[model samples]
Target: MEHSFHYLLLANQATVHRQLLAKLKDTGLTLGQPKVLDYLQDHDGANQAEIARACHIEPASLTSVLNRMEVKALVERRTQKGDRRSFAVYLTGQGHSMALRVRQAFEELEEQAFAGVSEAEREQFLAVFRRVYGNLKEGER
Candidate 1:
């Protein structure tokens, strides 16, 4: 039985995500939390809306994550300068250290996921994946 391309693609993604999540569990972080920290590592002091967009999460969901992280002392939200209505998200020292570990974990997970694939095959996979992404994105327009 042949699996549809979408099914195979999504299955592979889910498997890899699960493995990564498991590894992150040892660090006392979850999938959602690492996403926020990863974004902050690249774009520090971004407002909540910006972080949500970059992390591809909803505002409501991001708010809940931020609240939890604040309680953990992983991040702090401060009013944006000259913008009382907007709050910027900043990683605490602990968050910065955690972000590095999270980054390493993700990299290791990806490496493990593609372990058996040849370099040529990996390149082909990425090219095909990007085409698939473009096709789906274009369809949405």
Candidate 2:
């Protein structure tokens, strides 16, 4: 009845993600919201389609997340200069600040998670993770 290594890894990831997300709730951000914020932080004024692609989220889901962020005054959506039908997304000053905090929280959480792990072990773990991710994604193609 022992779980496989992959199962344990995935379970640990899920648990950690959930725990960190709970900590972020007070910042008025969710796990998915920060992805869009982080993208916009680096590439401001991106259209929904671009944001969705970069964030690896479906357009529909991105739309919902953007809507909520807009309502919270974290993002602003404006008509594109050439295309009135297309809107560009930008993070407000508040959103930019929150993005920084969110990034810090993620770093802290990761450090806490791997507190006792050596740097060599961490790099090896990341390599294995990337390979596993590639293997799983290859099956869908």
Candidate 3:
């Protein structure tokens, strides 16, 4: 198969996902859970909508993910001040520990992925990827 942009993008995503899942196997987390955990580590107390947006997940999907997290005793959703209809999400102690694990997994992957790559090369790749991302986002609008 030709190494087209679409093929490379999808292949890289699948490969990375597989590696991450392997690393997180003992955690019993599924595909979307790690992303939410990672995001909530830095943005604890964010609302459902904020989490969905930041994590690029649909609101309905995020709801289910949050429900599972709640079941695992990894997170809590408290009623927001002055907004009975809205809730702010928070991490449990276990969730914080899991977040740290997730961060380490990500760092290990980054190190492996960039092994032997020059700093200048990494910067150039990031610059190009940013433009590619911007182009795709622009197409959505």
Per lDDT, the best of the predicted structures is: 3
Local distance difference test values of all predictions, in order: 0.87, 0.86, 0.93
Give the TM-score of each candidate.
0.86, 0.83, 0.96
Decoy 3 TM-score against native: 0.96
Q: Which ranking of candidates, highest lDDT first?
A: 3, 1, 2
Worst 10 residues of 2 by lDDT: 1-10
Residues 1-141, model 1: lDDT tens digits: 239887887788788778778877777776589889888999889999899878888999999999999998889999987778899999999999988988888889879878999999999999998998889979978
Model 1 quality (TM-score): 0.86
Candidate 2's clash total is 0
lDDT of 2: 0.86
Higher-ranked by lDDT: 1 or 3: 3
Least well predicted 10-residue stretch by lDDT in candidate 3: 1-10
Best by TM-score: 3
Off by over 4 Å in 2: none
